[model samples]
Structures are given as C-alpha cells and as structure tokens.
Target: MNDDLRRAVRQVLPGVRTDLDALVRIPSVSAAPGSVEQVRRSAEMTARLFKDAGAPDVEILDDIEDGLPAVLARYPAPPGQPTVLLYAHHDVQPAGSPGQWSSPPFEPTERDGRLYGRGAADDKAGIAAHLAALRAYSGRPPVGVTVLVEGEEEIGSPNLGTFLARHKDKLDADVIVLADADNLTTGTPCLTTALRGMAACVVELRALEGGVHSGSYGGGVPDALTALCRLLATLHDEQGNVAVEGLATAVPPGAPVSEAGFRAEAGLLEGVQLLGSGSIAERIWAKPAATVLGIDAPPVATASPTLTPVARAKVGLRVAPGDDALKARKALAGHLRHHTPWGLQVTVVEAEVAQPFVIDARGPAFDAARRAYGEAYGNDVVDIGSGGSIPFVAEFADAYPQAAILIASAGADADSRAHGADESLNLADFERACLAETLLLAELTRSG
Candidate 1:
C-alpha cells in the first residue's frame, strides 16, 4: 500500500502542479480592504478541488455573520476507524508591490526548483498539499477525512472560533492536522511543537494643538512624533531585549540552533550582531519580542518641515508560549505609558490578542505521524517551534481536548520568504509533504 501510494502521488504531481499554478493566479489577499470577492473565489476554488476528489460532502461555509468563506469537506469514517481532520488556509497576505517581485506577484512562476507568487508558500501551497494527498488515495482513504480551508487566517482568524463552535459536529476528529507553518529548513521534515502567541495595539501621542513651523518652534517645544519615537524606543533595553514588565519569558525546549546557520537563514548582513540573548531558537521561540508594525507619520514624499501635533503607531508583541496574550498586551501598554517622555498625552487602544500553546507531541497519533514523515523524507523528523501565532490553534485545543493536533510544515521552508515580497515554495519539499501526509493517513488508520 505504501508503494502504491508513492506511485500514486508521483503520478498526480503534474496535475497538482497545474492546479497550484491556477490557484495562485487568484489574488486572494484577505488583508486588503476590497478583497472579499477574491477571498470568495479562492474558497470556491478550494471547494471544487475537494469535490472533484470525491468528497461525499463539500461545502463553502460562509454562514458566520461577519466571516469570509471557508471550505469544509468530509468523508465519513469506516465502522471502527478514527477520523482525521486536515486543515489549511486559502487566504494570503497582500503582495506589497509589483516592483518588489521579479515576476508578477499573481503569476506563479517556476525558477530553479521553486514556485514564486503571493500565497505560494504561506498557505496556498498548504491547500495544494492537502488536495494532492486526497487525490493520491483516489479520494478513498483508510480512515475518515475532513478538510477545513479557511479564508481569513492572515487576518488572525477573528471569526474562526465562533464558526467552529457553530459547526463543531462537521469538524470534530480524533487526529487533527494543521498543514501550516515552516520547517527548520528546506528538505527537513519537522512538526511545530510550540508557537508564540501575539498581541497588538495602536498607541497615539498628542502634544501641541496644531502643526507649527520647525524653525519657529525648533529648540524648546518638543514634537509629538519625537515623543512617540522616544516611547517606542523604551520597549527594548540597550541589549535589544524586551524591557516590558509583567510578561512571561523563558527558554524553550529544543536543540540549540547554530549562530552561523541562523544568520544565513535570517538573511542578516555581514558583521550585524544579533539582538537579545541565548540561542536563536530560544530567543525567537520562547522569549517575548516586540515590533513596531506601522506608524501614521507623514511619508517622505509628502513631508513638510513642520512639528506634527499628533503621532500614532501600531505596536505588536509576541507572547511567550506559557504567557497570556491579554496580560502581555496590557503590560506592553503600561510600559509605553510609564515611559512616556515629557508627560505627553497618550492613548493606548488595545487590539486583538491570542494565547500561546505548547503541544505534547508524544502520543500514538504523533508517533505514527513522525514515523510516516521520516519514511517519506528519508530523514528523522524533529520537533521545532514557530515564532508566528496561529490564533485558531488555541481555539481548536479548547474545543477538542482529546484530539491529537499535528502542526505540519507542509509548504514553507527556511527561505520561502512567506508574508513578504516574492514569496515562493520549494517544489521538492512540497512533493515530500504530500507523500508524508499520504503516509500519515494510513498510519493513523493502523494506530486507530
């Protein structure tokens, strides 16, 4: 059966490649203001793939009041077999600019061994991997299968929890596979065992009543933008560590990553020292980190020499695995306000926050998955951590405590450049991912 599955996956690769290209052509940028239609088209495309794969029930679930579309397809389990839930997302981050990419962002192009386009790695290829695995079995697996491809993951899945509650029966399973996240590197099969949660806020500082000429008000009176910059600088200490109090921080459980490899992977310039302390894995995976997402200051092209009266910035903080996201967000706000320079008027409007999670990947289902991926990749599988947050992961854990959740690095690798310009997927790794999932389903059946 394993050989047959391998042959089947090899045979379906061409079709899968074509489908992936076509799917990548759609600009399903969920974060854009006018992207509803594109997101719907992507969801519809995902639904058609599952329907064609012989799913008994395929639905585009858009019933959530303020939610975008999602594809849910199910095939009932055999009498004694446990069900397996497969997950991915059809939506993607916005492609920044046409100039930032070599080829057109919407046109999927193959160069060397990768396919480049928006959503090619972050999640759209995740959808393709699921489709390929389903097709490899001719749409008839050893156990029951359920596929969930959501439309708003890039936007933090605001409505996912409510939708899951309303449609719990359709999604419940014994083993859940989250086919998102990145591997340790290209050609290395890994399962994400820990993910740092995230919190965000928009902070505004007000000083003078109106803008004044820089020369007229140069020396004595401070500008709002300068004060805002000073406040933002206090988030990190001299050594580049997050100085915010009351946030959880700890070293993660993983093998230490080499400094040279880390520098190359992160694309750091020569002689640029890394910030913070400990191994790269520990700093990124377990410790808290903060970033200024965006500022509402005047652009260089439209700038005038004047003291701006008001300045605002959107701040983002990554919560450690064991920390509470809301608490960390509050602490971040507190630090910003406490360190405000010159007693400037400040307002911290809180934004979305998601709790972190750590997976105990030692059960039978996880064992089976690890073995299957090892066999498929010809390398032993390893445990890794992700700095990015997937809000729905916590929601899934709360909804189904007994299920064994598997977070697979199905499409992304170290150099995929996900959520950035010219994002791409390693083609060879993608094929291995399909084979790994195909083996995983059969392995789950035996374990069950």
Candidate 2:
C-alpha cells in the first residue's frame, strides 16, 4: 500500500511543482507594508488548492485585526480513524536585494534540478507537500486530515495564539506535522525534537546630551559608542561562549553533529575558528547564544570627527530548551546595565519573547512517522535539534498537550539556502517528503 502511495505521489509531482510555482510567484511578503492584499491572495489560493484537493470544508480565517489571512480546511475522518493536522505557512520573507539572486526572486525559475524563488523552500513547498499527499490519496485518505496554512509566520506569528484560541475545537487533532523546519542534510530524514526560545531587546547608552567635537574632547570625555561597544563585548568571552549569567544550558540527548558537517553546513570561511566549547551540536542546539543584530552608528562613508552623544544596539538572545525566555531577557538586560562603562545611563527595551520547545517523540504517532520517513528516504531517521525558534510550536504544545507533534521539513540543509540568496528546493527531497506524509497517514489507520 505504501509503495502504491509513493508511486502515486511521484505521478503527481509535476502538478505539485506547478502549484508551488504559482505560490512562489505571489510576492506575499508578510513583513512588507501594503503587502496584506498579496498575503490575502496567497491565503485564498491556498484555500482553493485545499478545496480542490477534496477538502469538504475550507475557510479563510481573518479574525485578527490587521493580521494577514490564513486558510483552514478539514477532511473528515473515516470511522474510528484519527485526524492529523498539517501545518505550513503561505506567506514569505521579503525578496531582498534582487542583485544578489541568480534569478528574479519571485520568478520561480528552475535550474540545476532545483526550483529557485523567495518561498521555494522556506514553506510554500511545505504546503505543496501537503497537497501532494492529499492528491496521492485521491482526496480521501484512510485517516482524517486538516490543513492550517498561516500567513504571518515570518513576522513572528503575533496573531497565531489568538487564532488558535478562537478555533481550538476546529483545529484539534490526534497528530500534527509541522513542515516549517529542515532535514539534517539532503536525503537525510531528521526529526526536530527541540527548538531554542528567543528574546530580543534594544540597549541604548547615553553619555552626553549632544555630539561634541572629538578633537577638542578627545581623551577627557566619554564616548557613548565606545561605551556601548564595551558593554556588548562583555556578552562573549575570549573563547566566544555566552558570558551572561543566570541563563540555562542543558544539552538534549542526541548524536552529536560532527565539526566537519557543521563547518560545511555553516559555510564558514577558510581558517575561521568555531566559537564556544562542547560539541558543535551542543553549542548551537542546546545552549544560549547572543548576537548583536545591528547598531545605530554612522556609516563610514558619512562619518564625522565627533563623539556621538548616544548609541543603541539591537541584541538578540537564543534561550536553551527548558529555559525561561523572560528570565533570559532580564538577565541580558541586567548584564548590560551592570557593565555600562563610565557610569553611562543605559536603557534596555524588551522587544519579543518566545519560549523554547522540546517534544517527547516516543508515542504511536512518532513511531509511525519514523517508519514512514525511513521508508520514504531509504535511511534511518535521526533525531536532531534546531537552533531557530518557532514560537507557535510552543503555543501548539500548550494548547494541545495530548496531541503528538512532529517537526519535519521538506527543504533544509545547506544547499536549500532558505531565507538567503539563491533560495531553492531539491526536487528529490520534496518528493520524499510528500511520500512520507502519505505513508504516515496510511500508517495511522493500520492495526497496532
């Protein structure tokens, strides 16, 4: 039965790619102003596709004020069968700097056996995978299915909790397959068991009331930029581990990813040394990390020989699994305050906070997913951790504590370049993902 389903998915690959192409061409960037209509168009298109795929009930969910649209559809379960919720996002990130892309960001160009576009791999392919799985079943699978494609995942899913709260009964299911993550590597099926939480803030240091001529007050006066730089430097030590106190760092149980593999995956320049201690996977996947996203400083081209009065920097922190993001944010802010140079006045404004997630992958649904992924890829499925934060994952876990949550992806790995230049999806991985989902649904309906 699974073999037949795989063949069926293979036969529908062309149509799936066509639908993905249509989705990739929409330019539905959720972060851009005035792009709400484009987001709505994408959501409507997604609804139409779900309806075409045999979903008896499909609706556009736009309950949040000024929120981008989402699509919801349900295929009722056969008697005594379980329902699975398929989650993906229809909106995409902005196509930045067209000059950096090999082809137009929204053109959906095919080259070197890969599809290139803004949303080609990040998530549009995920929606296409769900569609392909439904098509493989001829729109009526052994198990029930629900599709919930959101429109604002890229912008932190501010309205997702509200939507989920309002429609809890409609979206409840026995299993959930979140296809917004990545495989460990191409052709290697990986189940993401943990994701780090995130916290961010803007730290401002004010030393003087106005800019002063550096030539006149060179050594006597305090420079806010220098003070800010010093405070930021205290975040990391010489070995580059996060130097902040009161943050959690507990490594999850998993096979360590090798240094060579991480180096290749990270695309490090030659002779660049890796930072932090412990295994590469532990440092990245299970520990806190802080990064200075940007600073409010004058460009070198427009520099003036003056001591700036104030300087501000946006600091982003990734909390380890099992850690409290709010606590981490407070710790970071306190660190900045304590390390302020020359008694400079400092202000830290907290921005966003999202808790980390860790799933217990030891139930029937996970067993089914493991078998299905192994069958699809002809390899053993490995458990892994993602450093990136998906706030909605935690929300889903809180809302449906009993439901099995599976974190799988069709496009991950170094070559996918998701959210980067030359973003593309490997056709083989995409096909395997479709087959995996189809087989998972089939497995759910079988006798234990």
Candidate 3:
C-alpha cells in the first residue's frame, strides 16, 4: 500500500509543482489595500484547480457581506466510510519591500530545492498539497473528502465563525486535517497539538487640544506620541516579560530548544540578547507576548519640532496556551488605561480576541496520522505548540466537539520565514506531505 501511494505521489510531482507555482504567482494579499480583485482571482483559480482534478464541481462562496470569497467542494462518503475535511487558505501577507527579496515576491522561484514566494510556504503550498493528495488517486479517494480553501487566514480569519455556522452540513466531518502549521525543521515532521490564542487592539492617546511649537512649549508640555511611548513601555518589565497582570502562562511539553538553534532560526543580529527566562520553547510557546505592530504617527521624513496632539498604535498579543484571549485583551487595555502617562486621555479600540486551544489528539485518528507521517518521512513525528494562533481551529472544535482535529504543516519550517520577506517552501517535504496525506486517506478507509 505504501509503495503504491509513493509511486502515485511521485507521478504527480510535475503537475503539483506547476500548479503550486501558478498559485504563488498571484498577489493575493487579502489585507492589502485594493486587493479585492486579486483575492477574487485567487479564489477562482483555486476552484478551477480542484474541479480539473476530478472532484465534484466546486463552488466559490462569497455570499457573506463584506467578506472575501472561499472555495469549497466535497466528495460523498461510500458506505460505512468516515468523511475527512481538508483545510487551507489562499490569502497571502502583504509584501513589505521588493528590494528585501532575492526574487520578486509574487514571482515563484526555485533555488537550493526550495520554492520562494510570498505564500509559497505559509499557505499556498498547503492548497497545493491538498490538490496533489487528491490528484494522487485521480481525485477519487477511498474515503469521503471535503476541500475548503479559505481566503482570510492572514487577517486572523474574522469571518470564519460566520462561514462555519452557515455551512455546517457541508463542512462537518469525522476528521479535520488543517495544513497551516510549521514543522520542527527541514524534513522533520511535527504534529501540532496546541496553539497560543491571538488578540489585538489600537490605543490612541491625546495630550493636547492642538499642536504647539516645541520652542514655545517643549520643556513644560508633552507630546502625545512621546506620552504614548511611555505608556507602551509599561506593558513590559525590565526582563521583557509581558507586564499584563491577568494573563496566564504555562510550561509547554516539547523537546528542549537550544539557544544557538533558536538564534540561527530567528536570524537575530550579533550580540542581541534573548528575552525573558526559562527555556526558549517555554518563553515563546507558553508565555504571552505583546508587540506593537504599527503606529499611526508622523513619519520620520515629515517630523518637525511640534508637540503632536494625538498618536495611535496597534498592539498585537499572542495569548499563552492556557489563557483566555478575551481576558488578556482586557488586561492589556486595563494596563494601558491605568498606566497612561501624564494623565493623558487614552482610548483603547479593542479588536478581535481568539481563545487559545488544546486539541485532543490521543485516539485512533491521531494514531493513523502518526503512522502515515512516520512512514512518509522515515522518522518519528514530534509534537509541538505553535506560537502563532489560528482562531478557525478553535472555532471548528467548538462547532463540533466530537470530531477529531489534527493540525499538520504542508511544508513550512522555522527557516521558511512565513509572513516575512524571502518566504520559501522546502520542495522535498512538500512531496512527502502529499504522500503522507494520501496515505492517511487510505489508513482511514482501511481501518474503518
């Protein structure tokens, strides 16, 4: 069985690369300004790919108001066979600067056996993996299959709950395979078992009614930007741990991560000290981390000697695995309010907060996945926690508590630099992932 599936995946490699490259060529940055048309084009292209692969006719569902389109198609289950839902997203993050990339961010390039592009590893590769797995059996798997390719995962998938609620009958399955995580290393497979939740907010500080000349009021008065900076400083202590009091922390169970390996994978500059205490994995995967994503302030080029009246900053928080995202968001907001510098008037515009989740991965579904990935990679699978958050996973679990949810990476690793310039996918692991999924389908059908 394994040999046949390997040969099937090997035969499909050329077409897989061809389609993966084609998908990577589209600049489908869902959050970028003026990207509606590009996102639509991506959804259309994804639908066509699945339809051409011999699945049932696909549908591009965009009925939700003010929401991006998502493509979905399903193959009915045969008698006494369990159904599986394969999930991935088509959206990519905005490319910051073309000069920062070795190749054009939108143009796929292959070097050193890696495919380079914006969405190549982050999620476009995931879509390609699903296509390859279905095409491995010529789109008629032994078990029932449902493919749902969403378009807004990069923006935290705000509309996914709505979609899930509306499409329950079409999406429910015995098992869910979410291929949007990261492996431990190149050629090393990781079965993600937990994820830190996510939260965000924008805080605005107002110091004065209007701007004033620095020469006239610099020493005696304060600028809102400076006051905002001071207030933001209170969010962290001297050791760089999050200062929010209500947020909870945990000690995640995983293989210890050496500081040297962490430094190399993170691309830290020479002499930059690591933050906070315990092991590297515990600090990142088990603790709440806060960051200022962007500031709505005067540009450096446009700065002048003036006491700015107002300043706003966006705060992104990765909630720890054991904490509540809503409570953490309130804690952050409370800290900002109480720590307001110089009694400055502050307004915290709270954003979405997705609660952290721990998947129940100890049953037959997981056992089958482990055997499949181990056989495909010729190595034992390691379990890891994602420092990043996927709200949709938690939502799917909530919607169907009895279903088994398995999170695995399509091909991303620490070096992929997802959401950063020069993002790339390891092609060898990509093929292995396709083979693993194809084998998993057979495992499910055979065991049942």
Candidate 4:
C-alpha cells in the first residue's frame, strides 16, 4: 500500500505543481486593504480543487465578519473510521518591495529545485499537499476528511474564533493536522510539540510640542526619537537576552540546536554575534524575545536638520511556553513606560495577544504520524518547538479538548523563507509530506 501510494503521488506531482503555481499567482494577501477580492478568488480556487477531488459539500464560507473567505469541504468516513481535519491558510503576507525579490512575487518561478513566490511555502504548498494526499486515495481516503483553508492567518486570524463557534458541529473531528508550521530540517520529518505565544503594542513618546531646528535647540532640547531609541534599547541586556522584568522563561526539552545549524538557518553573516544566553533552543523557543518592528520617524533620505517632537514604535514580544500572554503584554507595557528617558510622556497601547501552545504527543494518532513520517522521509521523526505563534492552536485545543492535534508541514526547513521575499517551497519535502499524510490515513483506518 505504501508503494502504491508513493507511485500514485509521483504520478500526480505535475498536476500538484501546476495547481500550486496557479494558486500562487493570485496574490491573495489578506493583510492588504485592496486584496479582499483576490483572497476570495483564492478561496474559490481552493474550493474548486477540493470539489474536483471528489469532496462532497465543498463550500466557500464568507460569513467571517470582516475576514477574508474560507474554504471548507467534507468527505464522510466509512463505517467505524475516525474523522480527520486538515488545516492550512490560503492568505499570505504582502510582497513588501519587488526589488527585494529575484523574481516577481506573484509569478511562480522555478529555479534551483525550488518553486518561489509569496505563499509558495508558507501555506499554498500545504494545501497542495492535502490535495495530493486525497488524490493518492483517488479522492476517497480510508478515514473521513475535512479540509479547512483559512484566509486570515497572516493578519492574526481575527475572525477564526467566531467562525469556529458558529460552525462547531460541522467541524467535529477525532484528529486534526495543522500544516502551517515548519519541521526541524529538510528530509527529516518532525512534529512540533510547542509554540511560543505573542504580545504586541504600539508605544508613543512625546518630548516636545513640535519639531525644533537642530542648530537652535540641539544643545538643550530633548528629542523624542532619541528618547524612544533609549527606551527600546532597555528591552535587551548585554547578553542579548530579554531584560524585561516579570516575564517567564523556560528551558526547552529535547536536543538543542547547534551553533552551526542556527547560523546556517538564520543566514547570519560572519563576525556577527548571536544574542541571548543559554542553548539556542532555549533562547528561541523557551524565552521571551522583543523586537522593535518599526519606528514612526523621518526616513534618512527625507530627514531635516530638526529635532523631532514625537516618535512611535511598533513592538512585538514573544512569550515563552507556559507564560500567560496577557500577563506578558502587561509586563512589556510596564517595562516600556518605566524605561522612558528624560521622564518623557509615554503611551503604550496593546495591539494583540495570543497564548502559547503545547501538545501532548501520546496517542494513537501521533503514533501513526510518527511511523508514517519515518517511513516517508526515511529518518526518525524528531520532536521540535516553533518560536512563532499560531493563536488558533490554543483556540482549537480549548474548543476540541478530546481531539488529537498534530503539527506537520510541507515546508520543513529554513530555506523556505516564509513571509519574506523569494519565499519558496522544496518540492521534494512537499512530496514526502503528501506521502506521509496518505500513510497516516491508511494507518488510522487499520487502527480504528
């Protein structure tokens, strides 16, 4: 059966590539104000693929408040079989600047064994993997199937909770596969067992009423930009670890990421020192990290010889596993306010917060996934942690407490460059993911 499944997926690889390319060309960036129609189109295209794959009741659901449309499809299980839900996002991040990309962001380009484009690896490949799995079974897997392709993940899935609440009964499943995360590396299948939470805010500082001439006021007048920079600098200590008080940090389990692997994966330049203390995994997956996303200051090219009056910065904070996101947000806000320079007036507005996720990988579903992944990739599956946050994972855990949730991925390495320019998918990894999922379904059927 495994050989037959492998052969079936190999036969359909061309069609899968074509579908992925077509989906990638839609420019379905949900965060852009003018891309709603494109998101809808992408959702429609996803529904068409599922419908064509013999899925019954495939529909494009647009009832998610101000959110982009979502595609949902269902294929009932044969008698005594368990139902499985497949989750992936159809929306993608906006292509920041065309010049940063080697090829156009919307046009799918194949080069050096990768298919490059926005959403190529982040999630469109995930959807294609699901389709491939179904195709391997001739659109009728041994176990029941439900595909939920969301369209607002990039923007933090603002409407997912409401959508899930409204459609709880229809979404009931015994197991779920969230294909939005990455594996440890290429060719080594991994199950992500932990994910950090997130907290973010916009902090504004005011030092003067208006800009003043640098020549006239440079000596005595306080500059908001300078104060803001000072405040942001306090977020980290000399060792590059988060210096914020009241935030929790943990020691991650399992093998730590080596320095060489970290440098290679992060694309760090020579002579550049890594930040923080402890093992690489601890610094990334088990500790809080703060980043100043953007500052509302004059650009270098447009700067004038003036003293800035006000400056605002967008700050993102990653919360370690087992930490409360709301508590972390409050701690971050307090830190920003207390660290203000020159006693300048400061305002911290909370933007968003999402709790961390930790899954218990002790069940039949996980056992099946492990064996399937090992067989598909020809390597022992490893347990890993993701520094990124997926808010919906906690939500799904709360909503379906009895269901087994698994974090798997088609894009399993740093080279995927998800959410960045020249985002690409490794075709070989994607094919292996499809085979793994197919085998998992077959294993579940036998176990059930």
TM, every model: 0.98, 0.97, 0.98, 0.98
Off by over 4 Å in 1: none
**What does the lDDT read for residue 88 in candidate 3?**
95
lDDT of each residue in 12-118, candidate 2, tens digit only: 88898899999999999999987888998999899999899999999999988988899999999999999999999999989889999999999999898788999
**Model 3: per-residue lDDT, tens digit, 148-212?**
99999998888999999999988989999999998888787888887999888899999899999
Q: After best superposition, candidate 2 residue 386: deviation in angstroms? A: 0.3
Clashing residue pairs in candidate 4 are none
**Local accuracy of candidate 4 as per-residue lDDT tens digits, 228-258:** 9999999999989899999998767585687
Clashing pairs in 2: none
Please provide, for model 1 over 22-95, each residue's C-alpha lDDT reduced to its tens digit, 9 standing for 90 to 100: 89999998888698899999999889989998898999999988789999999889889999999999998888
Q: Lowest-scoring 10 consecutive residues by lDDT in candidate 1? A: 249-258
